[model samples]
Target: MSAVTELSIVLQHDIDEQYQYQPGEIIRGTIYVTLAKPTAIREITVKVYSEGNVSWKGPDEQVYQAQEVYVDSSKAIVDTTYDIEPLQLPQGRHDFPMDYILPENVPSSYIGKYGNVTYTMKATVVGANSRDTAISSEPFLVLRRQHIPVLAQQPLSMTASRRMLCSCSFGKLDIRVTLDRGGGVPGEDVFLQAELKNQSGHTVTAMQASLIMTTVFRAQSRSTEFRQVVSKKRDEMDVSRGEGRRWTHVRLPLPPYVPESKLEFCDIIELDYVFQFRVEMTGGSEVRLEAPFWVGAQPQGLEVPNNEQAGRRIHKGWTVRGSQALLFPDGGPGDGENGAGDSGGQQPHVEHDYDEGWGITLVPELRNASEVVTNPLYQHQQNHVTKGARDIPEELLENTKL
Candidate 1:
C-alpha cells in the first residue's frame, strides 16, 4: 500500500495570479496529506528554500554556476519517536499550517537564459520501513523594490573622439551624446540627443543608440559579467569634411518586465543598465560612447489624472451652450433683464442690505461750491493754481468776474 495517497500545498493569497512576496514578508500556507491505510511514518517535514543556477558556454567548455540559498527553512510536522506522545498513523486527511518569514535582504526573483533565481516549498513524508519518501513541491516568486539613486535624478552626457590616419592623411571624428534624465521606469522612453562632427576625410556611415543590460555573476571566487543589447535604434547619415549632424531626440523604449538596478540583497548577482552610442566611419574606427543609468520602481502617488473625464465635462458644457443658443435664438430663459419680460412687467432687481456695522463703508460725493469747500486738499490746490499762472491772469479774472 502507498504510504501517502495525496500531498498538496496551498498559499494564503495569490500575487498577480502567482504566489509573489517581497523581503520581510511572511509567507503563510498549508500542507495537506492523505493516507490510503494506517501506516507508520518516520517524519513529515516541510521545507522552504531558494536557489540560483547559472550555466554558460565558455570558449572551450560549458561552465556551471550556483548561488547560496537566499532563504531556507525546515519544520517537522510529525516525528514518530521524537514526539512527547507516540504518533499514530491515520487513514484520513491531515492538514498542517506552515509559516515562514523571508529575510530582509534578498534578491528579486529572476529567470535568465544562463541562470535563474527561484524559491520553492516542499513537503516530504518518510515511511518507517521503506527508504522511499513521498514528496510534493511548489514554486513562488519574489520581487524586490528598487530605490532610485541620486545619480539617476540628473542628466547624463558624454563625448567621444576617434582619429584615423591613411596614406599620410589624418582625420578626426567627435561625437557628443546626452540624455534628458539618467533614469526611467519601465514602459517609458529615454530620449537621446546627440551631435556628430566629422572633420575626417572619410564620410560618416551610421549612428546608433542602444539600451544595454549587464548582469554580473560571482561564483567560486571568480566574477563574470555579461552584456546584452536589449533595445537599439539607429540613423544613417553622410557627413563630408567639416560637416556636422545632430539628432534632436531619439527614443529608446524600456521593457516593463526587466528587473531594476543592482539586485542588492543577492550577494552573488547584480544587474545594471547603460545607454550606448556608436558612430561609424567609412574607413576609420567607430567612435563609441556609453553612459550608465538606472531603472527603478515607479514612485507611489504619482498617478496621472484622468483627462478623459475632464474632456467630457468641457465638451458637455460647450454642447449645453450651443443647445441653449439654438433653442432661444435671441436669449435663453435665465438671460432676461432683472427677471422681467420686455412687455412692461414690473420686476425690481432684488438687493440685499446688511446691517451698518457689518463691515460696510459709505463715500460722499461733492457737487456744488458749498460741498467742494469741505475738501481741504481741494482748497489748498485752488490757492496754488493762481501762483503758477501768468501775472495778468488774476487781474483779468477779477475784472471779468466783477
Candidate 2:
C-alpha cells in the first residue's frame, strides 16, 4: 500500500471517564481520522497494546529483567473490524464508533490497569495496503462503581490455600492464617494477619511466623528469581486449653512496580502469598502449615521477555524507552470544601531497600555498590523531593538501576 501524504487522529474528548460496571458492561468510544492524500486500503483494524518493565537482581547476581506488550488481539472488548472505503482525494474526517460487551468470564478485578487491573482504551486504524496502523491511546478512569451482587462477587474474597489438613498419627493440631484484601494495586499497602491454635492436647512452648511472596512462573524460569524477601518477624508465645495465638500485626508494602507490571496478562504474575507459622510443644510435637493467599494486579494478556528480538512488535508510535510510576490521589481529599489543604502536609513515602545482590547490573560503569532506590524513580541528590519523579526510560539500562 502507498503511504498517505498526511495522517491525523483525534479523540472525542480529552478524558473519557467510564464509571465502573460489572464485567459485562459495554465500553464505547469514537475516533476521527483525516488523510491529506488519497490512499488505497483494504480494511482498518483496531487494537490496544500495554507495556511494563521490571528490573531486579537474581540469585546469580545478574540483573533479572522482564517486559510485556500486547495488542488485545482477542479483541475481547470489541471484535468487528471496519472497512475503509477507498477515498480518491480530499479525505476530511471520518467517525469511528466502538461498542461491545466485556466478556462475562472476564473478572471485574482484572478490568482496570493496562496489564493487571487498570483499564486502558486504545483505538488502532490499520491501512489496507500501507504498513502503517494509526493508534489513539486512551486511559479510562472508573470513578463510580456499580454494586455487584454480593454472591456474584464472592470470588473476590475466596483465597487459594495450600494448607494440608493436620492428621498426625499421634495427635492433631489446628492452624489457620488469613490476609485481608488479598489483592491490591501496585503501590497500595497490604495488611496480613496470622491466627494459630494448638489443638493437639499439648501446651505450645514457642512459635515463629513469616510472610513471603512466591512467583508461580516467570519468563526466565529461574527458580532463584521466584522468591522475593518480603517482611519477616518472629514472636514468642505460650498457649493452653486449646489456646489461640495471634502474632504482632505486620504490613507488606507492595514494592513499586515499573508502571507496566501486571498480574493477569503474563504467565509469571502468579503470586502465592504465604503466611506461615511454626510451633513446638513439650510432648515432642511439631507441625507446620502454609496459608496461601492471592494478590491481584492490573490484567495484562501476556508478557514479552526483555530481548533484542522483541523490539519488532510495536512498529508504530515511538517506544520512548522509559519506566513510569503513577500514584493514585490517595483517593482522599485534603481539606474540607474543595479538598485542598491550605498548607502542604507530609507526603506519604515508602522506603524500598535494594540489596546489591538482588539484581545483576549490565553496565559496570554505573554505580558501584547496591542500594535501596526509593520510589518516584528520579535521582535524589539529597533526601528531599527536588523534582517531580517521572517514568524510567526503557532504552538506558545503565541508569535503570533498582
Candidate 3:
C-alpha cells in the first residue's frame, strides 16, 4: 500500500469586493495548491462543502438537530491533478489553479455558530500504484454578519411620523381673494385683489401660477365644471416664506358674449383655479396646487347662511353670453391625475369672455336639489377666501420695509 501525500492551499482576493455586493452576488476566488512532494496520483478533484444547523430539545430532554443543511460538489475541478506518469512538475514545487462557484443559497456563518456558513475546498488524489487516498480540507468564511447584541438592545421609535396617518400631515394652506364689485358693471371693468399665503413650512416653487375663477355645479346625480381666467398668473414669488404671504392685483373687462337666456340657478357654484409648482432645483419634480372657491344664490328671497359671504352675481340671461367666449388652451389644464387635480374624466372647463379681453368672470348656477356638495365647497373654500388673510392686513404690509 502507498502512503497519503500532504497538500497545501491558499486563497486570495482583492478589497474592492465589499460595500458593493448585492444579495445574489457571486463570490469568486482562486484555490492555489502546492504539493508536498512528488507522488503517484491519479487525479485531483475539488469539492466545496457546507452545513447549517438549528437546535431543539428531544422528548428525552436532550438537545437534538432541528435543521441540517448541506451544499456539496457546489464547485469542482473535473480532471485537474498531478498524475505521476503525465507531464509532472519538479519534485520540489507543484501548483494548480482551482476554483469553486459559490452557491446562491449559502448562509453567512462566523466564529463558532453553525447558522453561519463556511466554504472549504478539498483536493483528493488517488494513489497510482496503491489503494490509499489523500485529502486536505481548508476552512473559509462566507460573509460576516452584523453583531447581534446591538440589534437586540436598540429601542423602538415613537415619533409622530411613526403614528398611523401622521405622514399625511402636510397641513392646509389658505388663499384669499377679493373681487371688488364697485367698478364692475353690465359691460365694464372688474378688479380682483388676491393674496397667496404659504401655510405649510415647506417652500413652494411653482412652474406656472394662475388666478382663475371657475363655475362648478355638483349634485347627487351629476356635476359640471367651468373656469374664467382672471389674469396671466405666474409664480413670480421665488420663495413664499413659510407662513408668509404675497399679493396680486388684476383688472378684467367683461363683454356680453353669452346671452342672458342661458343662465340658471343651481345648488352650488364653484370657482376654482390651479397653481402648478415644481422643484426649481431639480426641474423634474413638480406639484400643482388648486385654489377653488364659490358663491351661491339665495333663490331671489332666501336668506344667505350665517357662515356665507356675498361673492358675485349676474342675471340669469348672461350665462350663455359668458359661455360663448370661453377660451381654453390645449394641454392647458394638464393631463392624467398628476397633471392637475383628480383625473376622473371630462376635461376641466375654463370660463372666459372676449368682450375686450382685459379680464374674465366666472358665473355659475347652483343645482337647487343637489346634496353631494363636498365639505370643501362650503367650509374650506369659504375660510380660504374670506378670513385667511385677516391676520396679515394691508396696513401691516404697507408699514413693513422690504
TM-score against native, each model: 0.57, 0.33, 0.30
Question: Which candidate ranks first by lDDT, i.e. highest?
Answer: 1
Q: For residues 24-57, could you state the per-residue lDDT of candidate 1 as single tens digits?
A: 5456677888877776777878787887766665
- What value does the lDDT take at residue 76 in candidate 3? 31
Q: Which is the leading candidate under TM-score?
A: 1
**Per-residue lDDT of candidate 3, residues 1-402 (tens digit):** 334434555554433222211112222344333444455556656666665433334356655432334456532333434433633433444555543334434444322211222456566655454454666776655431111222212221111111111136564334444444321111333344544444444444542334344444433333445555543434433443344344434444432111111112112222333322222212333334443222111112222222111122221111211333222352222233422333554554443332321133322222221332221111212335655555432221211112
Model 2, 1-402: lDDT tens digits are 434433333333334222332232334456555665554444444444334444456657786555554324323122224534543334555555543333323322222111233446655555644564465666542211122222321222212222233344233455554444434433444444555555545666666544456644344554333554454445554675346666333454554332222233444344455545566666666565565533333323212123331111221211111123212143112223322242453444332222222121221111112432122211122345548776432211010111
User: Pairing residues by index, what is the TM-score of model 3?
Assistant: 0.30
**In model 3, which regions exceed 4 Å deviation?**
1-5, 14-37, 56-60, 74-89, 110-116, 144-402
Locate the minimum summed-lDDT window of 10 residues in model 3.
156-165
Better candidate by TM-score, 2 or 3: 2
TM-score of 2: 0.33
How much lDDT does each candidate structure score? Answer: 0.63, 0.39, 0.35
